[model samples]
Target: MSRMSTPAESLTRPDGSPIRVLVVDDEQTLADLLASALRYEGWEVTTAGTGRAAVRLAQELTPDVIVLDIMLPDFDGMEVMHRIHGHQPNVPVLFLTAKDAVEDRVAGLTAGGDDYVTKPFSLEEVVARLRALLRRSGASAEKPANVLEVGDLRMDEDSHEVWRGEDEIHLTATEFELLRYLMRNPRRVLSKPQILDRVWNYDFGGQANIVELYISYLRRKIDKGREPMIHTMRGVGYVLKPAVAQ
Candidate 1:
Protein backbone atom coordinates (compact mmCIF):
# COMPACT_ATOMS: atom_id res chain seq x y z
CA MET A 1 0.00 0.00 0.00
CA SER A 2 1.24 3.47 -0.80
CA ARG A 3 1.70 5.85 2.12
CA MET A 4 0.29 9.34 2.22
CA SER A 5 2.66 12.33 2.34
CA THR A 6 2.11 15.40 4.50
CA PRO A 7 2.69 19.07 3.82
CA ALA A 8 5.48 19.21 6.42
CA GLU A 9 7.34 16.37 4.69
CA SER A 10 8.07 18.70 1.76
CA LEU A 11 9.51 21.51 3.91
CA THR A 12 13.16 22.05 4.88
CA ARG A 13 15.33 24.85 6.13
CA PRO A 14 17.73 26.27 3.56
CA ASP A 15 20.61 25.29 5.85
CA GLY A 16 19.47 21.62 5.97
CA SER A 17 19.43 21.50 9.79
CA PRO A 18 16.24 20.50 11.52
CA ILE A 19 14.28 23.64 12.47
CA ARG A 20 13.61 23.53 16.21
CA VAL A 21 10.10 24.38 17.47
CA LEU A 22 8.67 24.51 21.01
CA VAL A 23 4.98 23.65 21.39
CA VAL A 24 3.26 24.88 24.57
CA ASP A 25 -0.31 23.88 25.43
CA ASP A 26 -1.95 22.93 28.70
CA GLU A 27 -3.63 20.01 26.96
CA GLN A 28 -1.04 17.31 26.64
CA THR A 29 -2.87 15.60 23.78
CA LEU A 30 -2.93 18.75 21.70
CA ALA A 31 0.68 19.52 22.51
CA ASP A 32 1.87 16.07 21.54
CA LEU A 33 -0.20 16.06 18.39
CA LEU A 34 1.35 19.33 17.28
CA ALA A 35 4.85 18.15 18.14
CA SER A 36 4.33 14.96 16.13
CA ALA A 37 3.06 16.89 13.14
CA LEU A 38 5.97 19.33 13.19
CA ARG A 39 8.45 16.51 13.60
CA TYR A 40 7.21 15.19 10.27
CA GLU A 41 8.96 18.22 8.74
CA GLY A 42 12.23 16.93 10.21
CA TRP A 43 12.04 19.58 12.91
CA GLU A 44 13.42 19.25 16.42
CA VAL A 45 10.11 19.53 18.32
CA THR A 46 9.73 19.87 22.12
CA THR A 47 6.45 20.03 24.01
CA ALA A 48 5.47 21.72 27.30
CA GLY A 49 2.08 21.59 29.02
CA THR A 50 2.45 24.58 31.33
CA GLY A 51 3.78 28.12 31.11
CA ARG A 52 6.67 27.45 33.48
CA ALA A 53 7.76 24.41 31.49
CA ALA A 54 7.39 26.39 28.33
CA VAL A 55 9.71 29.09 29.60
CA ARG A 56 12.27 26.54 30.77
CA LEU A 57 12.24 24.66 27.45
CA ALA A 58 12.41 27.88 25.46
CA GLN A 59 15.56 28.86 27.33
CA GLU A 60 17.13 25.42 27.28
CA LEU A 61 16.34 24.48 23.69
CA THR A 62 16.67 27.92 22.11
CA PRO A 63 14.22 26.79 19.46
CA ASP A 64 13.99 28.56 16.13
CA VAL A 65 10.21 29.00 16.54
CA ILE A 66 7.45 28.58 19.11
CA VAL A 67 3.74 27.59 18.97
CA LEU A 68 2.20 28.72 22.22
CA ASP A 69 -1.35 28.31 23.51
CA ILE A 70 -3.04 31.33 25.02
CA MET A 71 -4.59 29.58 28.01
CA LEU A 72 -2.17 27.63 30.20
CA PRO A 73 -2.64 25.88 33.51
CA ASP A 74 -0.17 28.11 35.36
CA PHE A 75 0.00 31.43 33.49
CA ASP A 76 -1.26 32.74 30.17
CA GLY A 77 0.79 32.42 26.99
CA MET A 78 1.46 36.15 27.00
CA GLU A 79 3.46 36.06 30.23
CA VAL A 80 5.32 32.95 29.04
CA MET A 81 6.12 34.76 25.78
CA HIS A 82 7.34 37.80 27.71
CA ARG A 83 9.66 35.65 29.75
CA ILE A 84 11.06 33.84 26.74
CA HIS A 85 11.27 37.05 24.72
CA GLY A 86 13.70 38.47 27.23
CA HIS A 87 16.05 35.54 26.66
CA GLN A 88 15.67 35.20 22.86
CA PRO A 89 14.10 38.36 21.58
CA ASN A 90 14.64 37.37 17.98
CA VAL A 91 12.84 34.07 18.11
CA PRO A 92 9.41 34.02 16.44
CA VAL A 93 6.25 33.15 18.38
CA LEU A 94 2.88 31.99 17.01
CA PHE A 95 -0.05 32.25 19.40
CA LEU A 96 -2.78 29.60 19.34
CA THR A 97 -5.93 30.50 21.17
CA ALA A 98 -9.45 29.20 21.55
CA LYS A 99 -10.64 32.79 21.49
CA ASP A 100 -11.58 34.04 18.02
CA ALA A 101 -12.36 37.66 18.80
CA VAL A 102 -10.60 40.37 16.82
CA GLU A 103 -9.55 42.06 20.04
CA ASP A 104 -7.96 38.83 21.20
CA ARG A 105 -5.94 38.56 18.03
CA VAL A 106 -4.87 42.15 18.36
CA ALA A 107 -3.90 41.60 21.97
CA GLY A 108 -1.76 38.60 21.06
CA LEU A 109 0.08 40.56 18.37
CA THR A 110 0.52 43.47 20.74
CA ALA A 111 2.04 41.06 23.25
CA GLY A 112 5.12 40.18 21.20
CA GLY A 113 3.52 37.38 19.19
CA ASP A 114 4.66 37.11 15.59
CA ASP A 115 1.47 35.38 14.38
CA TYR A 116 -1.88 34.21 15.71
CA VAL A 117 -4.06 31.20 14.94
CA THR A 118 -7.41 30.54 16.57
CA LYS A 119 -8.49 27.18 17.87
CA PRO A 120 -10.34 24.53 15.80
CA PHE A 121 -7.85 25.47 13.09
CA SER A 122 -6.55 23.19 10.43
CA LEU A 123 -3.14 21.75 11.22
CA GLU A 124 -2.03 22.70 7.70
CA GLU A 125 -2.77 26.35 8.41
CA VAL A 126 -0.69 26.26 11.58
CA VAL A 127 2.20 24.65 9.72
CA ALA A 128 2.04 27.18 6.91
CA ARG A 129 1.85 30.05 9.38
CA LEU A 130 4.84 28.73 11.30
CA ARG A 131 6.78 28.29 8.05
CA ALA A 132 6.05 31.89 7.11
CA LEU A 133 7.22 33.09 10.52
CA LEU A 134 10.38 31.01 10.26
CA ARG A 135 11.17 32.53 6.89
CA ARG A 136 10.56 36.07 8.08
CA SER A 137 12.71 35.49 11.19
CA GLY A 138 15.66 34.18 9.12
CA ALA A 139 15.81 30.95 11.12
CA SER A 140 18.34 29.42 8.76
CA ALA A 141 21.90 29.46 10.12
CA GLU A 142 23.49 29.80 6.65
CA LYS A 143 24.69 33.17 5.44
CA PRO A 144 22.62 34.51 2.56
CA ALA A 145 24.44 34.48 -0.76
CA ASN A 146 23.96 36.59 -3.83
CA VAL A 147 22.50 33.70 -5.78
CA LEU A 148 19.77 31.16 -5.07
CA GLU A 149 19.18 28.06 -7.16
CA VAL A 150 16.16 25.76 -7.10
CA GLY A 151 16.35 23.23 -9.88
CA ASP A 152 17.01 25.33 -13.01
CA LEU A 153 15.57 28.53 -11.51
CA ARG A 154 18.25 30.94 -10.32
CA MET A 155 17.88 34.27 -8.56
CA ASP A 156 20.62 36.80 -7.84
CA GLU A 157 19.64 38.26 -4.51
CA ASP A 158 22.01 41.22 -5.01
CA SER A 159 21.56 42.14 -8.68
CA HIS A 160 17.87 41.08 -8.74
CA GLU A 161 18.41 38.85 -11.72
CA VAL A 162 16.44 35.71 -12.49
CA TRP A 163 17.05 32.85 -14.93
CA ARG A 164 15.33 29.62 -15.83
CA GLY A 165 17.71 27.20 -17.46
CA GLU A 166 19.71 29.53 -19.77
CA ASP A 167 16.90 32.02 -20.47
CA GLU A 168 16.99 35.25 -18.48
CA ILE A 169 13.71 36.53 -17.06
CA HIS A 170 12.80 40.08 -16.26
CA LEU A 171 10.66 40.85 -13.22
CA THR A 172 9.55 43.88 -11.24
CA ALA A 173 10.91 44.22 -7.70
CA THR A 174 7.68 42.84 -6.29
CA GLU A 175 7.72 39.98 -8.73
CA PHE A 176 11.34 39.25 -7.94
CA GLU A 177 10.66 39.11 -4.22
CA LEU A 178 7.72 36.81 -4.84
CA LEU A 179 9.79 34.48 -7.04
CA ARG A 180 12.64 34.46 -4.55
CA TYR A 181 10.20 33.22 -1.89
CA LEU A 182 8.94 30.48 -4.19
CA MET A 183 12.49 29.43 -4.98
CA ARG A 184 13.27 29.33 -1.29
CA ASN A 185 10.69 26.60 -0.74
CA PRO A 186 10.89 24.87 -4.11
CA ARG A 187 8.51 21.92 -3.82
CA ARG A 188 6.42 23.00 -0.86
CA VAL A 189 2.98 24.46 -1.49
CA LEU A 190 2.69 27.98 -0.09
CA SER A 191 -0.70 29.50 0.62
CA LYS A 192 -1.64 32.90 -0.81
CA PRO A 193 -1.93 34.48 2.64
CA GLN A 194 1.56 33.26 3.39
CA ILE A 195 2.74 34.71 0.07
CA LEU A 196 1.11 38.05 0.79
CA ASP A 197 2.55 38.19 4.29
CA ARG A 198 6.10 37.38 3.15
CA VAL A 199 6.19 39.17 -0.19
CA TRP A 200 3.85 42.10 0.43
CA ASN A 201 4.80 42.42 4.13
CA TYR A 202 1.20 43.10 5.31
CA ASP A 203 -2.29 41.83 5.15
CA PHE A 204 -3.72 42.36 1.66
CA GLY A 205 -7.29 41.71 2.91
CA GLY A 206 -9.32 40.70 -0.19
CA GLN A 207 -6.58 41.59 -2.66
CA ALA A 208 -5.74 37.92 -3.19
CA ASN A 209 -6.20 38.63 -6.88
CA ILE A 210 -2.89 40.45 -6.72
CA VAL A 211 -1.13 37.17 -6.15
CA GLU A 212 -2.90 35.70 -9.18
CA LEU A 213 -1.93 38.68 -11.29
CA TYR A 214 1.73 38.42 -10.36
CA ILE A 215 1.69 34.68 -10.84
CA SER A 216 0.35 35.19 -14.35
CA TYR A 217 3.12 37.66 -15.05
CA LEU A 218 5.70 35.16 -13.76
CA ARG A 219 4.27 32.30 -15.81
CA ARG A 220 4.43 34.42 -18.94
CA LYS A 221 8.04 35.31 -18.32
CA ILE A 222 9.42 32.05 -16.92
CA ASP A 223 7.15 29.28 -18.13
CA LYS A 224 6.28 30.36 -21.66
CA GLY A 225 7.72 27.97 -24.27
CA ARG A 226 9.42 25.98 -21.49
CA GLU A 227 8.71 23.16 -19.10
CA PRO A 228 6.34 24.83 -16.66
CA MET A 229 7.44 24.94 -13.04
CA ILE A 230 4.84 26.98 -11.14
CA HIS A 231 1.75 24.97 -10.23
CA THR A 232 -1.60 25.80 -8.67
CA MET A 233 -3.25 23.51 -6.14
CA ARG A 234 -6.72 24.78 -7.01
CA GLY A 235 -8.20 26.06 -3.74
CA VAL A 236 -5.00 25.68 -1.73
CA GLY A 237 -2.28 27.83 -3.35
CA TYR A 238 0.88 27.70 -5.50
CA VAL A 239 4.06 25.67 -5.54
CA LEU A 240 7.33 25.95 -7.50
CA LYS A 241 9.23 22.89 -8.59
CA PRO A 242 10.88 21.26 -11.58
CA ALA A 243 8.61 20.24 -14.41
CA VAL A 244 7.05 16.86 -13.98
CA ALA A 245 8.32 14.27 -16.47
CA GLN A 246 5.75 13.48 -19.15
Candidate 2:
Protein backbone atom coordinates (compact mmCIF):
# COMPACT_ATOMS: atom_id res chain seq x y z
CA MET A 1 0.00 0.00 0.00
CA SER A 2 2.92 2.32 0.73
CA ARG A 3 5.16 1.48 -2.20
CA MET A 4 4.98 3.55 -5.39
CA SER A 5 4.58 1.96 -8.84
CA THR A 6 8.00 2.80 -10.28
CA PRO A 7 9.96 0.00 -12.05
CA ALA A 8 12.91 0.74 -9.78
CA GLU A 9 12.59 -2.64 -8.07
CA SER A 10 13.36 -4.70 -11.18
CA LEU A 11 16.66 -2.91 -11.62
CA THR A 12 18.26 -5.31 -9.14
CA ARG A 13 20.96 -7.65 -10.34
CA PRO A 14 20.90 -11.35 -9.38
CA ASP A 15 23.76 -11.25 -6.92
CA GLY A 16 21.78 -13.24 -4.32
CA SER A 17 23.92 -11.76 -1.57
CA PRO A 18 24.15 -8.74 0.65
CA ILE A 19 23.84 -5.39 -1.14
CA ARG A 20 26.60 -2.86 -0.41
CA VAL A 21 25.50 0.44 1.06
CA LEU A 22 27.02 3.80 2.00
CA VAL A 23 25.86 5.88 4.96
CA VAL A 24 26.73 9.59 5.16
CA ASP A 25 26.01 11.71 8.21
CA ASP A 26 27.76 14.53 10.00
CA GLU A 27 26.97 12.92 13.31
CA GLN A 28 29.39 10.04 13.38
CA THR A 29 27.56 8.11 16.10
CA LEU A 30 24.26 8.01 14.25
CA ALA A 31 26.07 7.03 11.12
CA ASP A 32 27.75 4.17 12.90
CA LEU A 33 24.50 2.98 14.44
CA LEU A 34 22.77 2.97 11.05
CA ALA A 35 25.73 1.25 9.44
CA SER A 36 25.70 -1.41 12.11
CA ALA A 37 22.00 -2.01 11.62
CA LEU A 38 22.39 -2.33 7.85
CA ARG A 39 25.25 -4.74 8.32
CA TYR A 40 23.13 -6.80 10.67
CA GLU A 41 20.63 -7.04 7.83
CA GLY A 42 23.32 -8.66 5.67
CA TRP A 43 24.14 -5.51 3.73
CA GLU A 44 27.78 -4.45 3.40
CA VAL A 45 28.09 -0.97 4.84
CA THR A 46 30.41 2.04 4.49
CA THR A 47 30.36 5.31 6.43
CA ALA A 48 31.26 8.92 5.51
CA GLY A 49 31.40 11.95 7.78
CA THR A 50 31.64 14.55 5.03
CA GLY A 51 29.94 14.95 1.66
CA ARG A 52 33.20 14.96 -0.25
CA ALA A 53 34.27 11.76 1.43
CA ALA A 54 30.88 10.27 0.70
CA VAL A 55 31.20 11.05 -3.02
CA ARG A 56 34.70 9.63 -3.18
CA LEU A 57 33.71 6.54 -1.20
CA ALA A 58 30.61 6.06 -3.33
CA GLN A 59 32.73 6.24 -6.43
CA GLU A 60 35.19 3.76 -5.00
CA LEU A 61 32.72 1.31 -3.44
CA THR A 62 29.91 1.50 -5.98
CA PRO A 63 27.36 0.69 -3.29
CA ASP A 64 23.94 -0.55 -4.28
CA VAL A 65 22.18 1.91 -1.97
CA ILE A 66 23.03 5.07 -0.06
CA VAL A 67 21.76 6.37 3.29
CA LEU A 68 22.43 10.09 2.85
CA ASP A 69 22.13 12.97 5.30
CA ILE A 70 20.76 16.24 3.87
CA MET A 71 23.21 18.33 5.91
CA LEU A 72 26.88 17.68 5.26
CA PRO A 73 30.30 19.29 4.92
CA ASP A 74 32.22 19.87 1.65
CA PHE A 75 29.03 19.72 -0.48
CA ASP A 76 25.29 19.51 -0.02
CA GLY A 77 23.92 16.01 0.41
CA MET A 78 21.71 16.69 -2.63
CA GLU A 79 24.81 17.42 -4.69
CA VAL A 80 26.50 14.34 -3.32
CA MET A 81 23.53 12.27 -4.41
CA HIS A 82 23.67 13.88 -7.84
CA ARG A 83 27.37 13.23 -8.25
CA ILE A 84 27.04 9.65 -7.05
CA HIS A 85 24.00 9.13 -9.26
CA GLY A 86 25.94 10.27 -12.29
CA HIS A 87 28.31 7.38 -11.59
CA GLN A 88 25.55 5.00 -10.51
CA PRO A 89 22.13 6.07 -11.69
CA ASN A 90 20.15 3.22 -10.16
CA VAL A 91 21.35 3.48 -6.57
CA PRO A 92 18.53 4.37 -4.18
CA VAL A 93 18.96 7.04 -1.50
CA LEU A 94 17.35 7.02 1.94
CA PHE A 95 17.58 10.51 3.43
CA LEU A 96 18.39 11.05 7.11
CA THR A 97 17.88 14.48 8.55
CA ALA A 98 16.95 16.42 11.68
CA LYS A 99 14.63 18.67 9.74
CA ASP A 100 11.15 17.21 10.22
CA ALA A 101 9.18 19.80 8.32
CA VAL A 102 6.85 18.83 5.48
CA GLU A 103 8.69 21.15 3.11
CA ASP A 104 11.96 19.43 3.97
CA ARG A 105 10.49 16.05 3.21
CA VAL A 106 9.17 17.44 -0.04
CA ALA A 107 12.60 18.72 -0.88
CA GLY A 108 14.24 15.38 -0.25
CA LEU A 109 11.75 13.47 -2.38
CA THR A 110 12.04 15.95 -5.22
CA ALA A 111 15.80 15.65 -4.90
CA GLY A 112 15.41 11.98 -5.93
CA GLY A 113 15.46 10.52 -2.43
CA ASP A 114 13.61 7.22 -2.18
CA ASP A 115 12.66 7.70 1.46
CA TYR A 116 13.19 9.99 4.48
CA VAL A 117 13.41 9.65 8.25
CA THR A 118 13.63 12.40 10.83
CA LYS A 119 16.30 12.27 13.53
CA PRO A 120 15.96 10.28 16.80
CA PHE A 121 14.34 7.41 14.87
CA SER A 122 14.49 3.77 15.84
CA LEU A 123 17.24 1.61 14.38
CA GLU A 124 14.65 -0.96 13.33
CA GLU A 125 12.58 1.58 11.41
CA VAL A 126 15.65 2.89 9.68
CA VAL A 127 16.68 -0.61 8.65
CA ALA A 128 13.21 -1.48 7.40
CA ARG A 129 12.96 1.69 5.31
CA LEU A 130 16.41 1.17 3.82
CA ARG A 131 15.42 -2.34 2.76
CA ALA A 132 12.24 -1.08 1.17
CA LEU A 133 14.18 1.65 -0.61
CA LEU A 134 16.62 -0.97 -1.91
CA ARG A 135 13.82 -3.16 -3.17
CA ARG A 136 12.24 -0.21 -4.99
CA SER A 137 15.61 0.78 -6.37
CA GLY A 138 16.24 -2.77 -7.59
CA ALA A 139 13.11 -2.62 -9.74
CA SER A 140 13.63 -2.66 -13.50
CA ALA A 141 13.74 0.73 -15.22
CA GLU A 142 14.84 -0.34 -18.70
CA LYS A 143 11.56 0.43 -20.46
CA PRO A 144 10.02 3.89 -20.27
CA ALA A 145 6.83 2.14 -21.27
CA ASN A 146 6.94 0.77 -17.75
CA VAL A 147 4.28 3.29 -16.91
CA LEU A 148 3.41 4.30 -13.35
CA GLU A 149 -0.28 4.96 -12.97
CA VAL A 150 -1.33 7.35 -10.22
CA GLY A 151 -4.97 7.80 -11.08
CA ASP A 152 -6.49 8.47 -14.49
CA LEU A 153 -3.22 9.94 -15.70
CA ARG A 154 -0.48 7.60 -16.92
CA MET A 155 3.11 8.39 -17.65
CA ASP A 156 5.19 6.29 -20.06
CA GLU A 157 8.83 6.35 -19.05
CA ASP A 158 10.00 4.66 -22.23
CA SER A 159 8.34 7.04 -24.65
CA HIS A 160 8.40 10.06 -22.33
CA GLU A 161 4.66 10.50 -22.95
CA VAL A 162 1.82 11.30 -20.61
CA TRP A 163 -1.85 10.56 -21.20
CA ARG A 164 -5.19 11.36 -19.68
CA GLY A 165 -7.58 8.84 -21.21
CA GLU A 166 -7.70 9.41 -24.99
CA ASP A 167 -5.66 12.59 -24.96
CA GLU A 168 -1.99 12.34 -25.83
CA ILE A 169 0.00 14.88 -23.81
CA HIS A 170 3.28 16.37 -24.88
CA LEU A 171 5.79 17.62 -22.31
CA THR A 172 9.01 19.57 -22.43
CA ALA A 173 12.16 17.91 -21.09
CA THR A 174 11.88 19.69 -17.77
CA GLU A 175 8.16 19.03 -17.51
CA PHE A 176 8.61 15.37 -18.30
CA GLU A 177 11.32 15.14 -15.66
CA LEU A 178 9.08 16.83 -13.13
CA LEU A 179 6.20 14.51 -13.89
CA ARG A 180 8.41 11.47 -13.88
CA TYR A 181 9.80 12.46 -10.50
CA LEU A 182 6.32 12.93 -9.07
CA MET A 183 5.10 9.69 -10.61
CA ARG A 184 8.03 7.83 -9.16
CA ASN A 185 6.93 9.09 -5.78
CA PRO A 186 3.15 8.76 -6.19
CA ARG A 187 1.49 10.66 -3.28
CA ARG A 188 4.51 12.47 -1.87
CA VAL A 189 4.57 16.27 -1.81
CA LEU A 190 7.58 17.75 -3.61
CA SER A 191 9.05 21.21 -2.94
CA LYS A 192 10.40 23.72 -5.47
CA PRO A 193 14.02 23.87 -4.32
CA GLN A 194 14.14 20.10 -4.15
CA ILE A 195 12.67 19.96 -7.64
CA LEU A 196 15.34 22.37 -8.79
CA ASP A 197 18.11 20.35 -7.17
CA ARG A 198 17.09 16.98 -8.57
CA VAL A 199 15.33 17.56 -11.90
CA TRP A 200 17.39 20.57 -12.98
CA ASN A 201 20.86 19.98 -11.47
CA TYR A 202 22.58 19.45 -8.15
CA ASP A 203 24.08 22.91 -8.34
CA PHE A 204 20.85 24.41 -9.61
CA GLY A 205 20.58 28.19 -9.22
CA GLY A 206 17.08 29.54 -9.78
CA GLN A 207 14.07 31.14 -8.18
CA ALA A 208 11.51 29.06 -6.26
CA ASN A 209 8.85 30.20 -8.72
CA ILE A 210 10.55 28.12 -11.37
CA VAL A 211 8.75 25.27 -9.74
CA GLU A 212 5.43 27.19 -9.48
CA LEU A 213 5.80 28.33 -13.10
CA TYR A 214 6.45 24.81 -14.31
CA ILE A 215 3.56 23.56 -12.21
CA SER A 216 1.27 26.05 -13.93
CA TYR A 217 2.60 24.97 -17.32
CA LEU A 218 2.13 21.29 -16.52
CA ARG A 219 -1.37 21.76 -15.15
CA ARG A 220 -2.40 23.68 -18.27
CA LYS A 221 -1.29 20.86 -20.54
CA ILE A 222 -2.03 17.83 -18.38
CA ASP A 223 -4.93 18.92 -16.22
CA LYS A 224 -6.88 21.30 -18.45
CA GLY A 225 -10.49 20.32 -19.21
CA ARG A 226 -10.20 17.54 -16.63
CA GLU A 227 -10.45 17.11 -12.89
CA PRO A 228 -7.33 18.18 -11.03
CA MET A 229 -4.71 15.44 -10.60
CA ILE A 230 -2.05 17.66 -9.12
CA HIS A 231 -2.73 19.56 -5.90
CA THR A 232 -1.08 22.17 -3.72
CA MET A 233 -0.80 21.21 -0.03
CA ARG A 234 -0.77 24.80 1.24
CA GLY A 235 2.56 25.60 2.94
CA VAL A 236 3.94 22.15 2.24
CA GLY A 237 4.50 21.46 -1.48
CA TYR A 238 2.80 19.69 -4.41
CA VAL A 239 1.46 16.18 -4.65
CA LEU A 240 0.08 14.23 -7.63
CA LYS A 241 -2.77 11.82 -7.39
CA PRO A 242 -5.66 10.51 -9.45
CA ALA A 243 -8.26 12.97 -10.63
CA VAL A 244 -11.34 12.65 -8.51
CA ALA A 245 -14.61 13.41 -10.28
CA GLN A 246 -16.49 15.79 -8.08
Choose the strongest candidate by lDDT: 1
Q: Model 2, 70-112: lDDT tens per residue?
A: 9997788899988887877667788888886667766875665
Model 1, range 93-187, lDDT digits (tens) per residue? 88999986666876776565766777887777778788766655556543345698877888877555688888888664456668888988988
**Which segments of candidate 2 are over 4 A away from where they belong?**
1-13, 139-246
Q: After best superposition, candidate 2 residue 123: deviation in angstroms?
A: 0.9
Q: For candidate 1, report its TM-score.
A: 0.58
State TM-scores per candidate. Answer: 0.58, 0.55
